[model samples]
Target chain A: MIDEIIGLYNYWVVIFLMMTGFYVVIASTNLVKKIIGLNIFQTSVFILYITMGKVADGTAPILEEGITSYSNPLPHVLILTAIVVGVATTAVGLALVVRIKEAYDTIEEDEIHDQDDSL
Target chain B: MDNLAVIQVLLPLLSAPLCLLFNKARLAWMIAVVVSWAALFVSLSLLVMVNDNGPIIYEQGGWPAPIGIVYHVDILTAFVLLIVTSIAAVVMPYAGKSVEKEIPVSKQPAFFSALLLCMAGLLGIVSTGDAFNVFVFLEISSLATYALLSQGKDRRSLTSTFQYLIMGTIGGTFILIGIGLIYMKTGTLNMADLADRLPAVFDSRTVHASFAFLTVGICLKLALFPLHLWLPNAYTYAPSVVTIFVAATSTKVAVYMLLRFSFTVFGVDLVFAKLPLTEVLLPLAIVGILVGSLAAIKQSNIKRMLAYSSVAQIGYMILGISFVSASGLTGGILHLFNHAIIKAALFMALGAVAYQIGSTHIDALKGLAKKMPWTFAGFAIGGLSIIGVPLTAGFVSKWYLVLAAIEKEWWIVVAVLLVGSLLAVIYIWRVVEVAYFQTADDESDIQVKEAPLQLLIPLWILVIANIYFGINTSLTVESASSAATMLLGANS
Candidate 1:
């Protein structure tokens, strides 16, 4: 029982983080907080990919004279690309928040809804 | 010549940055027009090549598949490529005049650049064989769409853009997770490789979870029914040109993604037989059709009404898929093409109205037929297509859908299809009545003039296409059935 729990703990943590990030995105009213939630969710997915690539006693994916064991490098490269995409999304999200603040004088979702409704 | 598929995507991508170098709006518009038409020409040739020679597979950087990215040009990809590039071509000429009036001169060049980038991203999504590459291009198109939406004149567009940004990012992240899970199980990201390896592990819990994630994630992106909260507002407030392009292409590409994954990657037995996905999809699609048409009937603004109508049309595509027959898949794919042309024409006509009267409220369309006869004729024909009137492209797809349902003895589904078309009739007649029967209110002093020749030319192009494709069923029907056979034949 203990062995099974320990073996799958990384995925459990990934699920926990994913659920929390998803919850924050749904529950929060603040636009910046929603963006932060999105980042957390994406980072957790990155971790999920990286965790799956791990090998027992594996070192960094580098070539050497004697070393034969290496963690998978493809997922790492994919995550690097994903991180760049995540950063671009964040930058655009923040720029949009700035525009929203200028247009409506508030960044809270409910407040924005109220204002739009009044219009 | 062998790298023509690569050039189809590369042409638009490379032109985007070049558009940024131009300061004059006219120069930028000209660049966008020329590049988009070139892309269309390339797409048409690719379609012909695939039709005659079968599928063409091009490897990136001279690397083979399962190691590096590959551009797989199958019949489905070629067909969607034609739809997307053709819409981009038709919309660009209209975009020049629409943007000139709506957006400031300084912002026009960047707007065109963003549009080209969006087009490149969409074409890339349809062409690439790598699973992760879809997510990357999905984000590229999404971010560009957000920028395009923010260019709307109404301040409310800022909020709508933000809403779509949040939802779209969540969708993208979910897709990434799904891809990671699939990679974990099979150790491959190439879709063809994954299809080969997945069947051995089809019964695993992880595989099932991954399928769920991918379905939900793609459902969000395609604005399927209940998850479609961001679409009406995004379409309603966006500048008409942006609405026309995205309305015609974005969700349609997402539907193609769903088809690719469900039939090609997951296999029919796993998605349709081993699981109860079709059961869930059918009911939701029925509700989406009924509710979308009902909501569209109540909307006072013309753009919002059309946006709601798009939600319902997506439901028709989903309904066709859930039937899980060769004829049904053909119906779905045909709808993908037919809807693109029909909606593009409808939105362009509405755009012409907005250009002339500066609003898309049904009231603004009052007596519009008297002033803009060509534009209203386009709208009236497009509206008939939406209602699935005989001898229109819309009827072609709906006929296949109804036949598929009847073949399966799904009597209730047939009823839903007929009722949905009837609802479409009511909403379309509402607009036609306002445009033709009612007189314009004399107080506003709005000039009664026709749209410019630039907008009219493209608008009629799509309107003519709707009629031409409806009359000639050889191209759409043959390609759709072949694509369906290819997708289903892979599984059996």
Candidate 2:
């Protein structure tokens, strides 16, 4: 039981972060906070990918004469692409929030809807 | 040696940045029109090539498969390519007039650029054979979509766009996580390789979880019933031309993803025999059909009403998929193509109305048939197609769907199919009733003219194609059935 606990530590952290991010995304009323929550959620997935790439006592993937062990680099490279996508999403999300603030005069979801309802 | 498949994706992608280079909307729109037509030519050639040759696998940058990204253009890919490129070709020309009226001169170029980017992203998704690459292209298209949808003159567009962004990003991330889990097990991101390796680990918990993630995520993207909350508002609030382009293509691409992952990558046995897909998936589809049509009937806004109908149309495709038979799958894919044509034309007509009358509320459309005869005629014909009237494109799809259900002796599904068509008739009739039967308030003096010829030409083009394809079933039926046969191959 103890071995299992230690062996799957990365997964436990992923689940925790993922749930926290999702909760904030669902629970938050502020649009900016929601985008932040999305960032956190995406970050958890990045960690999950990096976790999959890890190997015990493995060095960074590089060609060398003496190094016999290295972490799998594919997942890390894939995560790099994902990181770019996540960044683009956040940029767009924040830009929209900025416009929402300009147009609605509030970043709160309830306020935005209330204003719209009045219209 | 052939570069047709890559060029099919690259034209819009390369031209997107070029669109940004121009400060003038006319220049950007011109570039878009040229590139979109070139894309259509490229895709038409691809369909022709795929028909003659079985499948063309184009390795990216001359790198071999399972190592580098390759585009696997089979009959299915060609069919989707045809749907997407043809829609863009028509919509891009229509945009010249619509964009000028709706958008300010300064922002118009950005709108055109974003539309091209969105098109390229969708084409990229359809062309790539790598699992991870799908997520990248999905985000590219989605980001561009939020930007496009938020361009509505109404402030509510911003809020709807925010809602869509939140939902779409979550969906894309779920797909990412699913792909990650599958990669953890198989150590490959190439779809063809994943399919080959998946059967060995069919019972693994990770595989099951991955499948679940992918399905829920795609359902959100495809707006499948309960997951469809984001769609109607997004479609309703987007600018007219944006609505026409997105309403026609985005969900169709998402459906393509569902088909690709479930059949091509996961295989039918894994989706049907191994997993409890039929029970859960089938009910959502049937409910989507009935509820979508019913909800469409309740809507007062024409755009929102059609948006709900799109939800139901998506259901028909999913319902066909749930059958897990060749005819069933054929019906599903055929509906995918036919719906793109039918819905594009329908949305295009609404776009023309929006262009003239400035809104699409049922009350606003009172006697609009008299003022805008040609445009309303287009909507009326497209409406008939949506209702599955004989000699329209919709009938061919519904015919196949009902036949497939009957072949399974799934009498309940067949009944639902007929009931769904009847419901469509009620909602479509509501629009025709308001447009043709009712008159505007006596003092209001409805002064709206027919939409500009720019809009009518493309609208009529799609409307004519709808009736033509309905009559000439050889092209769509042959390709769709062949594609279905390929997806269901060796499953027995």
Candidate 3:
């Protein structure tokens, strides 16, 4: 039951973070804030993948002599790639935000849309 | 021939980095053009090989399926490969002048590099058999796409790129989750293995949730009507070359994935019978068709109008799938090629107009036919294609769809298809009227001239392909029929 609770606990956290990140993205109007929300959303996914890597009473995926068991390594490797993608996306998003600030003088979504409309 | 398969994708993937090493814009462009043409040729050969031999199952690193990575070069993959390579091949020359005019000279290398990367990613997505490989290639293409779109000088492009980034991440995450769920249940990522394993686990709520999540995510990426809010702005604000590339191929690739997941992975019975996806999708596609067309009629910007029309066209593809007939799926699959040519030509013509003229706003196109006859003529042909007029590729797709609908006794859907075509006529006619008939307002002192040979060459290539394929649809129809059969799986 304790182990089951822990397993359930991990899933709950992933779901909570995912929902929170999605909420922030939808509710926030500031483009930068939305990017941050996006980061949180993607980070939650990284956590989910990492959690999947864990095996009960198992060591790291790298095999060593005398090791009876090891956790699944595929999710860990996939998450590493996902993290790289996340960082690249964030960097690109931030660069676009900087450009948006320079061009429109505002990074807020509503203001930019209003400005675009006026144009 | 099979060895050529892996190298086809790798050639452009390698060229992207090589192009980045170049400082000269012209040299970089020349390299991109050569690489893309080579990629197109390889893709064509693969299509022909697949046509003759059915599906070519290439085990990457010489490892068989249910164990090692695989690249399944079936009829459907070959068909999509052709669409993607064809677009890349045509878009390169147009990219040279379009990029020069819209983007600064210093940024051209990065722009072309991102373009090549996007192409490689799309090819990778289509060719790979590993489910996780799909996600990896998706990121490669999507990351490049964000950078490409942000190159647009318009301020809203930044915001549009940001919006797409957020949504794209969400979609990608959901797909990853779906893949993870399947992996947890089945312990394999190979598609054929998953297909076998999935049916046993189909009754499980976790697997069902994964299927739902994956479909929603891919459809969102495909810009399925209601989830398509990120599209119009992204298309309208993206640099002309980027717009052409994305409008032509991106969503179609996503649609490909959707069909892949639904038919190949999940199985049609599970997806359509158990989940009622067709019931849900059929109505939604109808809604999207009406909504997208109506919205397009209202847009003043030519690019935005085309973008919305794209949303409607996607609905038609989905609508075709909803019928569950071989002909229906063939219509959808064939439209995947036909619409790519139509939209690419349409956008290339628009890019040509935007190149010589300042803007793409419909009102600004006064007497453009008198000024740039070839460009307008191309636009007019593309317009007819979009409206499903006879002797254009679009007519063949709608004809197949209507035949399927009539066979299925879906009279209403057949009527809606016609209505959608009429709406396309309305929007296309609006632009034609402005371009041909409207007298110039005084501020239009810009010297109107036909687009340069470089731009005209690529633009007309697609325009001619649109009509040529309409007449000689043997290759398209045969490939599409085989693809539809494959999409429905071995037993439909």
Candidate 4:
């Protein structure tokens, strides 16, 4: 039962983060906030990958002076790549938001839509 | 010789960053144009090689697959590469003047760099044999695309980009999860190895679940009817050049990936036999076709209308595969190429119009045929193709699709396809009427002349290619037919 609780914990947190991020994206009017939500959602995915890589009492996969047991390094490498991608995504998202603010003078999605309608 | 295949993707990847270092616009355009042409040349060479030989495999950094990253260049990859690189070649020259106008002068360098990087990433995603590599390149292209789309002059573009980012992230995460699940079960990331190992665990629930996640995720990315909510707005609001690039290539690449996964990695029996994919997919495709056309009819903005038409065309491609016949598959793959060219030509024409008039509303296009004759002529040709008129590329694809449907005795599908073309005729006619028949809103605007030679050359190149390929379809038909056969016959 203890193992089951622990096993279920990671997915639960993932679900929580995913939902929170999704809700923020849907509910927030600010473009920046939506980007933040996107980050949160992406971060949850990273967590899920890291959790999948976890091995009981496993160490980092480094050929250092004295390391024997290592957690699965593949998922770690994949996640690292994903993190790089996430950062790139965030940077681009923010840049787009800046452009949006410049154009509309507002970050709110509804206001932008209203402006588009008026146009 | 085997190792040289990796350079097919790597050359552009390396050139992308060099673009950032060059501050001069002319130098950047020169470099970008050279790189695009080089990529196109490489793709053509790869196609010739694939035709002469068979698939080429390149293990990265002198390592073997199942242990290290690998890249595969099968006929399918070569075919897709030809489509993508050729489109880039045409779009690059247009990008020279268009980007200069739309994007700020200071950001032009970075914009072109991102464009090249995005192209490299897309090519990488299609060429690589590693599953995780697919996700990496998928993100690379998606991130670049978000930047490209946000270049629109409206704040609504930001919201649209954000919406795309949110949805794209979710889709990416889902794809990552699916890849991870596959990795967990098969213990290999190399696609060929996965294909070999998957049959052993085909009955595993984990495998099934992974397939489910992947199909759903890819469908979302590809903007299949139900999951296509992000596409129209993204295409409609993005900068004109970005719209042409994204509209022409991005989702088509996603669809290629879908075909790769469905036919190559997962095996046809695994997808078609155990899962109710065809049933689910076919119905949604039909809905996408009918509904996309209907939505397009209601759209006042030409760009937005074209965006919806793309959704419907995507449905036709999907419809081709649902029949699961060699001819059906041929229809699907042919439509893929035909739609890419047709849609690219249409959007490029629109871009030319936007270049002069600064808008794409249908009202603004009145008397455009008289004023901008070449541009509208190209559009009318594209419109004919879209309506599946005889001796056009669109007709060839639709003809094969209808043939496949008749062979299967699914006459209703044949009828639906015909009806879809008729609807296309209606919408295309509206544009035609406005362009050819309607009087100019201002007489002075009549002096508004044709698009510059730079734009017309590429536009007409595509127009003429559409006509030529439609008439002499030996190459496209042979490739598409064989690809269809391979897809259907895999694992049989």
Candidate 5:
């Protein structure tokens, strides 16, 4: 039973971080906070991918004279691409926040909703 | 011929950068029109090739399937490609004129570039057989869509785009996590290989969790019922041209993705039989149908009304899938095609109204039939199709859905389907009555001229397609059934 607990600890951490980030995105009203939450959420996913690629006693994926055991490199490569996508999403989300601030003069969701409702 | 699938995606992707090279708006518009038409022609040839020969698989870098990215063009891909490219082709002409009036002159060239990028991303999503590649193309389309949505004249569009950005990114991250979990278990990102290996781990809790994550994430992206909070505002406040393209293609491609994942990757026995996805999906779909149609009845803005109607139309598509029968899958796939043409035409007609009157408020459409007769005609025809009137494209798909429901002996679903259509009649009739019967409150507004030839021609093309495809089911019905069979048969 203890071994099972130890075996899946990485996934437990992943789930914890994911839910926390998701909660912040849902519960926070500040636009910047929400974007930060999104980044955190995406970052947790990156960790999940990277953790899954790790192999015990495995060396770097690069081939050497005697090394036959190496960690899987595919997930690392995939996560790199995902990180780029995350950055692009962050850039756009922040740009939209800037535009939203200009238009409504506030970045709070409740205030924006109130202002839009009045109009 | 194998390279044709690659060209379908590359044509628009290559043209987008070329669009940036043009300083003149007219040149940019010309480039967009020509390239979109080329995409249409390429997709048409692909459809014919797939219809005659079978699925076309193009391996990138000439590497084998397990190691290299592959573009897989089966009947399903070809059908969706036809819908996406045809909408792009028809929307481009209208976009040139619409952007001139709605966007600043200096922003026009960049607008076309973004539009082509959005198209290429959507095309990429539908064609690729690689799971990780789907995420790459999904973000490409999504980021471009955010830019397009923010271009609306209303300041509210900025907020709407932000809301979509937040929701879309979360959904995307969830999808990535799901793919990650699946990869952890199976160690392959190739979809067919994943399918081959998945049944071995079908009972794993992680696999189930991955399925749950993927379904919810995609539902959020496609705006399914409870997850649909972002769609109405995104459609309502977007520039009319953007609404015309995204409304018709984006969510439908998400539906295609859902179908692809459930049937192609996870297999039918696992998704439909072992899991209670149908039990969950059926209730949500039925509620979505009634709630969407009922909510649409309350909207005063025509654009928001149609946006709600889109939610209900998507409900019908999901309801068909929930039945898990050959006829049901056929109905769902058919609705994907039918709804694309119908909604695009209706939204384009609304764009025409907005261009002339500067608003899509139902009141603004009063006596519009007298002034913009052709546009109203397009609206009327498209609206009838939405109501599932006989001899229209909508009827064909709804007929299959009702038949599938009867096959399952599900009486409540049949009743819900009928009630949804009845509500569609109410909402559409409200517009028809306002446009045709009531006199304009301001007499001077009635003197507004017809929409430009560019807009009218595309609008009529889709309006005519709505009628043509309704009568001639040879293409749509055959492709949908063949695709459905392939999906179900692949798993067994």
Candidate 6:
């Protein structure tokens, strides 16, 4: 039971952080905070993918001598791309938040909603 | 074949930068028009190739799959390409005058560039057979869409864009997680390879979780029923031309993504016979249909009404899928293309209305029938199509849907389909009455002339297509039925 528990620790961490980020995104009212929460939620998946690529006693996937075992590198590449996507999303979100601040003078979701409703 | 499929996606990407370079609105518009129409031409030739030669697989960089990305061009790919590119082709020329009036001169270049990038992203998503590639292209389109929508003049659009970004990012991440899970199981991101390897692990819990994630993520992107909160405001506050383009293409591509994941990659039995997706999909579709139609009737803004109606129309497509038969899938797929044109025409007509009076509110449409008779006439025809009146393209799919429902002895679904059509008629007629019967208060001196020829031409073209496709159902019927059979054929 302890072995099983320790063996899958990464997955448990993944689920915990994923849920926490999701909750923060859902529970928070500030636009910037929501974005940060989203980034956290996204990074959890990066961990999930990286965990899948890991192998016991594996080294980086490179051809330099007689290393018999190598980690799977494809998931790492995919996460690299996904990380770029996350950054782009963050950049766009921040840019939009900046414009929202300019337009409404408030970055809180409730305040923005109230302004729109009043209109 | 001179590597046409890659060129179809690459053309738009290459052309987007050219728009930014031109810096002149007319020049940028011209570049957009030519590139979009060329993309359509590529789709046309591809459709012919796909029809005659069967599915063509082109490996990117001449490296075979499991190493390099590959594009698989089948009838389904061609059909989606036709819907997306044809709409872009029509909307691009229409954007010239419309963009000139709505956007500042300095922004027009970036506006066209982003539009082209969105088109490229959509084309890349549809054309590629790689699973991870879909997520990448999905983001490309989505980020551009946020930019396009935020360009709406209303400050409220900023809030709408922000909300859409949050929801859209979540959806994209869900899909990524789903893909990652499947990759963990299969060790390959090629869709065909995944499909081959997936059945071996169908009983795995991770695989099941992946399917659930994919469904919800795709549902969010397609704005399926309870997950569609971001659609109304996004459509309402978006600039008129932006609304026309995104409404016609983006959601339809998401629907195509749903079909690809459920049918091609996962197999029909896995989605329908083994799992209870139909149980979940059917009720949601029915509720979505009824609720969307009801909400549309209550909207004072015409654009928002059409946006709600689009939600209803998506329900119809999902309803067809829930039946889980070839004819049902055919009806659903046919609606994919038919709704693309129908909503594009209706939204284009509304764009013209907005251009003239600067408002899409019901009050602004008073006496439009006499003054902007051409625009109103187009709206009426498009409305009839949405209502599924006979001799319109909408009727063709509804007829097939009703037939499929009867085949299953699903009497309630049949009733729901008819009632949905009736609700469509009520909502459309509400607008018809306002546009035709109510006079633009005689004291006011607003001479509401017809929209510019650029706008009227595209609007009428789509209106006429609704009639033509309704009368001659051969193309939509043939492609949709074959696409359905191909999808189900994967099961056996």
Docking quality category of candidate 4 according to DockQ thresholds: medium
TM-score (chain B) for model 2?
A: 0.99
lDDT score, candidate 1, position B41: 96
**Per-candidate total of colliding backbone pairs:** 0, 0, 0, 0, 0, 0
lDDT, candidates in the order shown: 0.92, 0.91, 0.89, 0.86, 0.93, 0.93
lDDT of 1 by residue, B1-492 (tens): 659989999988998888889667888899999999999999989989999999889999999999989999899999999999999999999999998778999999899999999999999999998999999999889999999998999998888888899899898888888898999999999999999999999999999989989999999999998999999999999999999999999999999999999999999987898988899789989999999999999999989999999999999999988988999999999999999999999999999988988899988788889889999999999999988988999999999999999999999999999999999999999999998899988835757799999899999999999999899999999999999989989878
User: Of the pair 2 and 6, which is ahead by DockQ?
Assistant: 6
Candidate 4's chain A scores what TM-score? 0.85
DockQ preference between candidates 1 and 5, better one? 5
Higher-lDDT candidate among 3 and 4? 3
Q: For residues B1-492, what per-residue lDDT tens digits would candidate 5 score against the true structure?
A: 799999999988888888788767888889999999999999999999999999999999898898999999999999999999999999998898888779898888888888999999999999999999999999999999999999999999998888899899988887898898899899999999999999999999999999998998899998999999899999999999999999999999999999999999999999999999899889989999999999999999999999999999999999988988999999999999999999999999999999988999998888889899999999999999999998899999999999999998999899999999999999999999999999999886447889988889999999999999899999999999999999989899
| Candidate 4 lDDT, B1-492, residue by residue in tens | 665567778877888788789776777778889999988988888888887898888988878988988899877788888888989999898888887668898888788888888898899998999999999989888888887887887556667777788788778878987898888888789998999999899899878888888888888888999998888988988888889888888888888888888889998888888888799889999999999999999899999999999999999988987787899889988898899899999999998998888889999988888889899999999999999999999999999999999999997898999999999998899999999999878877546778888888888999998898889999899888878877777678
True contacts kept of each: 0.75, 0.80, 0.75, 0.75, 0.85, 0.78
- The residue ranges of model 2 lying beyond 4 angstroms of the native Cα positions read B443-446, B490-492
Q: Arrange candidates by DockQ, highest first: which order?
A: 6, 5, 2, 1, 3, 4
TM-score of each: 0.98, 0.98, 0.97, 0.95, 0.98, 0.99
Candidate 3, B1-492: lDDT as tens digits = 687678777987898887779767888898889998999999999998888877787788888898788888888998999999999999987898888789888888888888999999999999988899999899899999999988887777877788888888889888988888888888789998998888888899989889988988998899997899899999998899999999999999999999888899888988888898888789989999999999999999999999999999999999988889899999999999999999999999999988888699988888788888999899999999989999999999999999999999989999999999999999999999998888888745877788899999899999999999889999999999988877776535
Lowest lDDT 10-residue stretch of candidate 2 chain B: B439-448
Model 5 pairs in collision: none
> Per-residue CA lDDT of candidate 6, range B353-418, in tens?
989889999987887888899999999999999999999999999999999999999999999999
Candidate 6: true contacts recovered, fraction? 0.78
> What TM-score does structure 1 among the candidates reach?
0.98
Question: Against the correct fold, how does model 6 do in TM-score?
Answer: 0.99
lDDT of 4 at B306: 97
For candidate 5, the lDDT comes to 0.93
Angstrom error at residue B307, model 6 = 0.4
- lDDT head-to-head 3 vs 6, winner: 6
DockQ (C-alpha based) per candidate is 0.72, 0.72, 0.65, 0.58, 0.74, 0.75
